[model samples]
Target: MSKQPASYRPRHAVILAHPNPASFNGLVADAYCDAVRACGHEAIVRDLYALGFDPLLREHERPGTEGFRLSPDVDAELDILRGSDVFILVYPIWFGMPPAMMKGYVDRVLGAGVTSAQVQHRTAETVLRGKRLVGITSSGASKAWLNEQDQMDSLRQLFGRYLLHAFGMKAYEDLHFGETIEGLDQDYVDANLAQVGDRARAICAAIASDRAQGQAVPPAA
Candidate 1:
């Protein structure tokens, strides 16, 4: 039997939504996995829908106490996530929010002693710090239209303020490709693809830069 490579280790966890293989979201997810790997960062891609992830916050688990336990499969996912240094989300915005399954994953996985935990009894500070995040999304509407609505900014707030900030993720980035559904022009699609690739490069550069500078980034909104 061949031995495993000692040089291989994953550095990033990419959680993807949208079930259709033919969908643009799927293509973007694939691109991200490739990009991350090319930069020498191991990438763990979680196809939330394909995994049949249960998104419902069980009635008993609503308070997020020890109300629910992960099934064998979910437990496995949580374990993988726990080891990741960079957490990336690649999904399409439906009505300006995360897909149901992705949202549910957060509800189930992020809580006390997991994504975050309280510190000292006096200040109740958080210690689950030191992580990075990036959001990659596709939209059917034009960029101008999305700009008018401030869709991307609004989403940044949702992730930065609610999830990353709360969980102690230090840095955050977002990339969007709008007007996908209007028409699938090869030129247009290629341009967006290039943009995504650029973002991936930026992500790699930022990681190295931040580390080199000894900078701790605050989660962005």
Candidate 2:
């Protein structure tokens, strides 16, 4: 078990994308929050469905336009994302991708003039530099099947590499919980949920390690 720095308690933001509270994805999110709290950190759980997060990006929320504006909901989520040191996304995979609400959350909250900025003669500058990302995805398919289909590869590329990198985040861990609802037995599901707790602890440990190494923590916007 890794210990947090005695001086600082990192804030963790856990975003729950599944609509059903009884779902396995929700259980994972709950487990993560409990583990984060056990690590002596603050945990904020954003339940997208319960909050009624609008999945559609309205015209006003579009980027690179004069009249572009953010809704209060989007602004709030962005603030949470910026303030937290560790970001965890818990969602169920639908058709080899995150559900619509999670995708929309990424689309709206991670928009320009908020999480990133374009620079001349350089790659897009990300305001979310130095933050850590963890993705917890549940799917009905088996891990072997997902690997054979390259679904895990796609997730790693999209979220762990491309998306997080665009946000200037370098540290990431992607955890896949397959055969979650229908195809798996209770014991296997329990094991995956346990893994979620373990991963949460590991995330806290990594943050403490980074701090001990004098890594710069990104400033909140």
Candidate 3:
């Protein structure tokens, strides 16, 4: 039998979209997963599209009644996700947001008993406390255009604050690449992936080092 760590073992869950292997977003997601593992963390990858996870939030799935029961696949997803100290979202921005598949994963997995709940008239406090989160995204717009449009920057306000902070994520990071529209050169895609992959590794390394030293990993500057 293999030996295990004495007490601590860093665990991470990475969710990805874009099932197309030729897609730049998919390549970046794979690279990030590899980087996380290199940092000695147990990285779990969730490929939303390939998994065929239903994104629709029907009334039957709502919290309450027998309809709230999760399907076997969803239950498996929850199990993998709940074991992590860090959660990573890797996808491409389509029309200024994540794909439908990823959105659905959030709807089902991040629901009641996972993130937060309600108590009568007021909302209750969030769970998923002490967990960290990060995102890696690629978009078609040029960097200048996106900055001018405030797409990536505005996203932080949504996922970082409203979504993640509301659910008690202790840390969050985003790695975004742009100018990936039609006719984009393959060289650019490879270069961007290399840069983002290194960045991911650095971030995870910093976290591991901080934990090893018994200090909190400082947030991105």
Candidate 4:
């Protein structure tokens, strides 16, 4: 497999949001991280469920309050986010959206005074500009059903357009693996896992190409 140049290798923060260790989402996350490391980048995998991340935004954790203060856990996660050049999110679609823990991570860790700055008479200034985000989601429903119900579009809007753009980060692909695990053969599962590895390599290559050309990485379509 081709590797990214040492100078262009980027730091990656991989967030896994599934509760079950034996789930397909966990397999994908492991494959992604392995590919990232194989491509010569540093990959840190955070299993939110395993970490026992609090999915609630308490009043004290609310932004703009005198009592607003991040817990030690949030602080540590924020540090990982800040130190990484790329973010990879692997989760299962729960009610057509990311799980509560992932949403809570956004609310608390990426809240005001951390990943963004408020400016008078304008939108919040995104402090995470120049970073990249990629999301990999799995669903029990068929892709056709998701498309018919517009859940795919909703996912794109929520993660790619709204969330990443809000943070001024480049949205670099969102892969949805639908019809997950139920009645699927091992061959089919292996194929999807291979694709995950391929995507990881592609991400590294894109970043390296951008650096080589001295250009900002373009958002993935």
Ten residues in sequence with the least summed lDDT for candidate 1: 119-128
**lDDT per residue as tens, model 1, 23-42:** 78877777777887788777
Q: Is candidate 2 or candidate 3 better by TM-score?
A: 2
Q: lDDT of candidate 1 vs native? A: 0.69
TM-score, candidate 3, is: 0.81
- In candidate 3, what are the lDDT values of residues 28-62, reduced to their tens digit? 77787777777776777777877777887765566
Better of 1 and 2 by lDDT: 2
By descending lDDT, how would the candidates be arranged?
Answer: 4, 2, 3, 1
**TM-scores of all candidate predictions against the true structure:** 0.78, 0.85, 0.81, 0.85
Residue 122, model 4: Cα distance from true site in angstroms = 8.4
lDDT of each: 0.69, 0.78, 0.71, 0.79
lDDT of 2: 0.78
State, as a TM-score between 0 and 1, how close model 2 is to the true structure. Answer: 0.85
lDDT of 2 at 20: 88
Looking at model 3, which ten-residue stretch has the lowest summed lDDT?
A: 115-124
Residue 111 of model 3: what lDDT?
Answer: 53
Off by over 4 Å in 4: 1-8, 112-127, 215-221
